[model samples]
Target chain A: MTVLEARDVSYQYSVGTPFQITALEHISFSVEKGELLAIIGHTGSGKSTLIQHFNALLKPTSGQILLYGKDINETKETARDARFKVGLCFQYPEYQLFESTVYKDIAFGPGNMGLSKEEIDARVRRAAAFVGLTEPMLEKSPFDLSGGEKRRVAIAGVMAMEPEVLIMDEPAAGLDPRGRRKILEMIENYRRQTGSTVIIVSHSMEDVASLAERILVLNHGKIARMGTVDEVFSHAEELQNMGLNIPQLTGIFTRLNQLGYGVNPLTYTVEQAKTEILRYLHKGGAADG
Target chain B: MENDSLIKFNDVSYRYESDTDTPLPLAIKNIDLDIRKGEFVAVLGHNGSGKSTLAKLANAILAPESGKIFVNGMDTSDESLEYEIRQTVGVVFQNPDNQIVATIVEEDVAFGPENLGIEPKEIRRRVDDALKSVGMYEYRFHEPHKLSGGQKQRVAIAGIMAMQTECIILDEPTAMLDPKGREEVMKAMQRLNKELGVTIVLITHYMDEAVKADRVIVMDSGRIVLDGTPRQVFAEEETIEKAGLELPDCAKLAHALKRSGVNMPSDILTPDEFVEAFQRCVSGGGVL
Candidate 1:
């Protein structure tokens, strides 16, 4: 089922002024239920603007945003309704953590939804567990935790609402390897537990390659390509030309193929690359014979 | 070498006064560090590892609770030398949006020199040269807000360059940028380090960026756990991981190959190195 869709979406900033600029033009795509999609593009390439339209945060200057095959912006109540069903966690979410305690922070979203105290408490505990926050830490002020822990509080705040579709923008940016791993692990766990559709807006190709089921390449306000990981990543030269990056492990394979090594450039994960390179080495580098 | 060192820390220790007063107050423990002139150094650590604290100490943004930091033999703790110390060491923080002051790129770049009360002609020459050096001359008249993340960052670097600061410390400058923007900032830093012989102290989480630096410093729990050349530092895979960091994917693959009884070097940091190793293995006289 198509949970979220953009039909002929277009947006312009400062329209009809001397500084007028087209931010998005005729952008169209559909995201399925339970599918993990990563939207990638260079800075100011309309990624942030495109995500905003999904929840009717920014109505397309032209074009319709469809939720469950119905226009989300059809009415004021529907536009407000779409916000809860599609939780959008903006970049650097930790800075938005102004709650007194981690538990209260996580409960804020559900509280806004008018859930019962018992239900809100249950959801808060569950969300905290999803991000690996301890019982004692929940009582502490969200401001007192480490950078990684604080990030978890903000993510948990969004997850607590239990949105049908979860979208996070650069959740792991500026984190250490362990912190990043924790966030990635929590996302995988969240999907496995809830089977929710996940859309991540990120600039790190490596992170996208490791988790996303499909990838969307955005250019200067348009969809350059949208496909499964193999389809998008295999066209390494094309993505690079658009000022994007492939996974580091994939880049190695890409370079080897460019060097006449005949290695498979579709290798994205480290484990996959290890197996392919091992096979090639044991086979005397003969890729096909 | 000691005499030529631009910044030296003698048994430095810094403690952040947390509001909650949680344990682990020491942001950086007792340590000694020497940053020499014209050296390009990369600092690697996860968040809360005190790398930023070390950067702040270099220019006297924060005085050490204990120990002493000296910039150009002038103590950072000495209030009289504070201006000269900051003039000697320039720091660029993570967000370009926060660092930028003036509306226009050229004006922002010229802000430092103008603040230093340089002659109008000298400021004009320095601003143009600085902007040109960072490849942002074309965007000089453009609004700083209109430029891309990378362009804004380069403009920040140009602002520092206009001050003629001998050393530049960048704290996670590319963390918020896209891959292309990250690449652009790295190229500018490299150019500034090479062409002008400006010392660079880069604090980053990306292992790939660290590969370009002359030296790599890894911190864990507010202490330097590993410090050496990129090759030497990355060779300690276990140590890097223990510090809450990971090796670059290429280097990790090389290590995996080494563990599986292949003859690949454990320190391969880039795709080019990995390809060369694979080629060697495929050409025989190796595991096959």
Candidate 2:
């Protein structure tokens, strides 16, 4: 089932002003329930502008957004419901964290929903646990925590709402490899447990290659391409020309194929590359150099 | 005292003092390092690992509590030489929004040199030169707020370059930027190092970025745990793991291929190298 759909969406910044600029134009895509979709684009490529329309954060200047077959902006109640059903975790969300303590910060979203105190407490604890925050950490000032910890707390704030469709922009950005792995794993676990649709806006081709079931490529306020991970990444030259990158491993395989190596050009991960190389060697390839 | 050393840290240590009930941990402790002239040094560490503190110490924004720092020929601890030291060492912080002060692009790039009391004519020359160096000369008339994150970051770097600082230290300058912006900033750094001969000290969490540096330094628990060329440092998997880091994609794949009884070279740090090595092995009859 389609969880969210953008029907010919178009957005303009500062419309009617002298500096008005088109950020997204005639973009159309539908996100399925329980699917992990990765949106890849260069800077100023309309990835952020497009996602904002999903939760009614920014109404389109020309088109419409539908959540579960209902127009989000059709009425006030529908728009509000769309906001609750589609949670957005912005880039550098840690900066938005404002409560005195981590617990209070995570509780902010649920509290605004008018949930009972006991229900709020349970949701907050579960969300914190999903992000690997310990009980003692919830009591400490969010300011005193490490940068990675503070980012997790910010993500937990969104998770506490238990939205059916969670969208995170650049979720693993600015993290070391280990930290990136932990955060991505946390996101995966959350998706599995909740069976919620996950959409991530990312610049890392490697992260998208590994995690995303389908990928969307945006360029200059337009949908350049949208397909499965393999399908999108197969067009390496097109992505490079658009100022976007393919996974590093894919680049290598593409080069190898160009050089008459005849290797599998669709390889995106390390395991696949390793297996392909081994298979080539077993088929009478030499090691005499 | 080394003649070639542009910056030196002699047993540096720093700890933040907080009045809150919760105690703050030491920011950096017992560190010693030397950055030679015209070298590109990349610093890698997890958050709270004292990497930012190290950047602050380089330009005398934060003095060492128990050690000493020298920029070029001036001691950072000397009050009389503070201006000279700051002029010699420029720092570009993580957040581009915070560092940009001017509404217009050219004006922001001129902020640093103007503060040095340079004449207006000289400031104009420096501003034009800096903007062109970062490929932002076309946007010089544009408003800083209207520019993308990458464009704004380039403006920030140009601001530092206009000051004619001998060395530039960036504290996770690309942390908040998208991939394209990150690439733009990295290319600018490379140009500054290669064409202008300016020393660069980059602090980043991305291993791929670190691989492009002339040298990589890994810090943990407020101390330098690993320091070597990118190839040498990334070759040690155990050390990287202990320091809360990981090998680049190429290096990890090479290691795994080697373990799987494929003839893969161990020093592969990039995809190009990996492809070349694999082609050689396949044609030369390497054991499977």
Candidate 3:
């Protein structure tokens, strides 16, 4: 089922002025329920603006945004409903964490929905648990925690909303290897437990390859490509030409495939690369070497 | 004091004071290290591993509580030499916007030298040279806020260059940038380090960036756990993991291949190096 859809979306940044600019032109895509999608592009690729349109945070200057077959902007109430149904998380977790305590910060979103007091408490606890936050952490100031922990609190705030679709921007930005891995795992586990559609915007091609089921590549505010992992990453040159990157490790295998080694070059993860390289070497791939 | 050393740390230790009764652990503990002149050294560690603290200690931004740090053989603890120490060892932090002051790019670069009371004519020359070095000369007249993250970061580096600092310490300068921005900033750093003979101490979590350095330092629990050339340090795959870091993608692949009885080298850090090693191994050459 399509949880969100963008039909012929076009947006202008500065309308009717000398500096008028079209940020998005004829953009069209539909997000399926329970799918993990990643939108990738350079800094000015209209990714943020495009995601804003999904949640009705910004209405398209032309065209319609649909949530479950209904236009999100059909009425003010529906627009507000789309916002609650699609959770959009911005980068820099600290900016989103303003409440005094971690618990309050997590509770703020659910509280805004006018849920029952007990229901809100239950959702807050569940969200905190989903993000791996401890019991004592709830009483402390979110600002006082470590960077990783602060980010968890911010994630919990969004997860507490229990949106049908969870969208995060650069969820693992600025984290070390362990922390980065943890965020990716948390994103995965959250999707598994909740069965919610997940969308993330990222710059790390490696992370996107590992986590995302589908990739949406944007360049100059237009969709350059949208496909499965293999479909998108297969065209490394095109992606690279658009100021993007592929996993360097994958590049090696891909280059070998191009050189007639006949090795499977579609894999990006380490486990798959190891198997493919081992298979090639064992099969007397030594001649071309 | 070693004559070739630009920044030397001798048994240095520092801990932040806590306002509450709870005592805080040392941010950087008993670190004895030396960065020689004109060397590109990259420091890697997880958050709170004292990499930033070490950078701060080098520039006299934070005084060591136990030992001493010398920039050009001048003690960092000395109050009178603070200005001189900072002048010699400049720092570019992770967020470029925080360090940039002026609206225009050239003015932001000139802010450093201008504050030092340099004449306008000389300042203009220094500013232009610095901007050109970072490949941001064309953007010099543009507003600093309008430039991309990588461009803004290069402008910040130009600011330090205008001061003519002999050494620079950068703390995850590319952490917030995209791939292209990261490439731009990394290129500028390399150009400055190689062309101008400026010593570079970069604190980063990116393994690929660390591989380009002359030396790689790994810190853990406020101590230097590993220190060697990129090849030497990355060879210790187990130690890197214990330090809360991971091997570069190629290195990890090599390790996996070796575990599966393939003859790939365990120290491959980059994709090109991996491709080269894989070819040699497949050619039935002796294990390297």
Candidate 4:
């Protein structure tokens, strides 16, 4: 089922006293239910602008977005409902945590949805658990929690709304490796439990290679490429031309291939590379041997 | 102290004013370190672990409550050396948007030199030189906000480079950037260190970035927990894990392989290294 679809979306940002910048132009893509998509791009590639359209945070200048087969901008009331259905966790979401306690912060979304007190409490607790925030930590002041904890709480706030589609923009930005792993694991677990469509916008190719099932490459405000991981990563030259990099493992494999090694081009992750190498070794080192 | 030691922290200990316990919550504790001239040192630590505080201390943005800090032989605690310290070691913060004061790129680059009261002609020369060093001279006429995050960050670095300070401390300079932005900033730092002989102190969470530095310092809970070369520091996966930090992807894969009884180098940091190691293992029939 198509959980979210963007048809020829375009966005423009007014600049200076007279000029306007076209951030995105005629971008088209559709995300299916329970699928994980990653958007990769350089700094000015309009990945942020495109993701903002997923939740109706920014209206498309020329196209339309449909959530669950219903046009998001069909009506003002529908757009507001779209916001609840598609939860957006922005980059550096910790800055948005303004509530006193973590529990109160997580509850804010459910409360805004006009859910009952019991439902709000239940949602808050469930969201907290989804993000790996312990019960004791929920009652503590969000300001007192560490940076990673604050981030989780901020994500929990959005998850409490029970959005059918969750969008995170650089969710692990500025986090240590362990913190990054923990948060990504939490996200994966959340997806498993809820089966919601997840979109992660990140610059790290390794993260995208590891987590995302489908990859979308954005360049100069257009959909440069979109496909499965193997298909997208196989176009290493195109991605590099757009000032983006493939995963380091894929880069190494490409280099090896250039050096006359017959390594598989479909390998995107280190584990896949390892398995391929082991199989090749077990069958003798030569390609045809 | 050695003649070339640009910055020295001698048993420094600091606590925030808000904490009022018997032994206050130490922001940085028992830090005895020296940064030599032209050395590029990377500091790694989780958030709230006091690495940022240590960066601030190198420039005397925050004073050690109990110990002494010296910038180029001048004590930081002395009021007379305040200007000298500020002029000696420049700081670039994480948020480029917040640190940039001027609307235009060239004007932003000129702010540091202008504050130093350099001649107008000299200021222009230094601004041009700084922007050129970071490969941002072409965008000198551009507006700061119109630039990409990476470009703005490079402009911020140029602002410090224009100051012509002996040392530059960047606190998570790539935190707000994409991968390409990070590569650009890291390359700029390398150029400044190699070509200009400027001492570079970078505080960051990315292990891959830390690997490029000459030395690595890891902090946790306001103390220097680990300090060594990147290989030495990262080899201690236990300590890294205990500090709530993650290893680079290559390192993690290596560790995983080791756990599965594959004999690979634990110090593998890059994908190339991992690939080479795996190839060697295969040749030796090490893989099951």
Name the top TM-score candidate. 2
> On residues A32-142, what C-alpha lDDT tens digit does candidate 1 reach at each position?
999999999887788888999988899999999999999999999999889999999987799889889988999999999989999999999999999999999999999
Chain B TM-score for all candidates, comma-separated:
0.94, 0.94, 0.94, 0.94
**Candidate 1: regions farther than 4 A off:** A260-262, A284-289, B20-24, B121-154
lDDT of 3 by residue, B39-139 (tens): 99999999888899899899999999999898888999999999999889999997787899998899999999998999999999999988887678977
Interface DockQ of candidate 2 = 0.64
lDDT, model 4: 0.86
Docking class of 3: medium
Candidate 2 residue pairs that clash = A286-B284, A286-B285, A286-B286, A287-B284, A287-B285, A287-B286, A288-B284
Model 1, position A74: C-alpha lDDT score:
96
Clashing residue pairs for model 4 = A178-B246
Would you give the TM-score of chain B in model 1?
0.94
Worst 10 residues of 3 chain A by lDDT: A280-289
State the DockQ of every prediction: 0.64, 0.64, 0.55, 0.55
Task: Show model 4 residue runs off by greater than 4 Å.
Answer: A15-17, A260-262, A286-289, B19-24, B146-148, B252-266, B272-288
- 3 against 4, candidate with superior lDDT: 3
Per-residue lDDT of model 2, residues A154-247, tens digit only? 9999999999999999998878777898999999999999999999998888889999999999999999999999899999889988888788
Per-residue accuracy of model 3 over A179-286 as CA lDDT, tens digit each: 999989999999999999999999899999999999999998899999998899999889888878888767988888876776888878888887787777667676
lDDT of 2 by residue, B163-267 (tens): 989899998888766666678788888988998899999999888899999999999989999999999999888888888887887788899988887777888
Question: Isolated chain A: TM-score per model?
Answer: 0.96, 0.97, 0.97, 0.96
Which whole-number lDDT from 0 to 100 does residue A240 have in model 4? 77
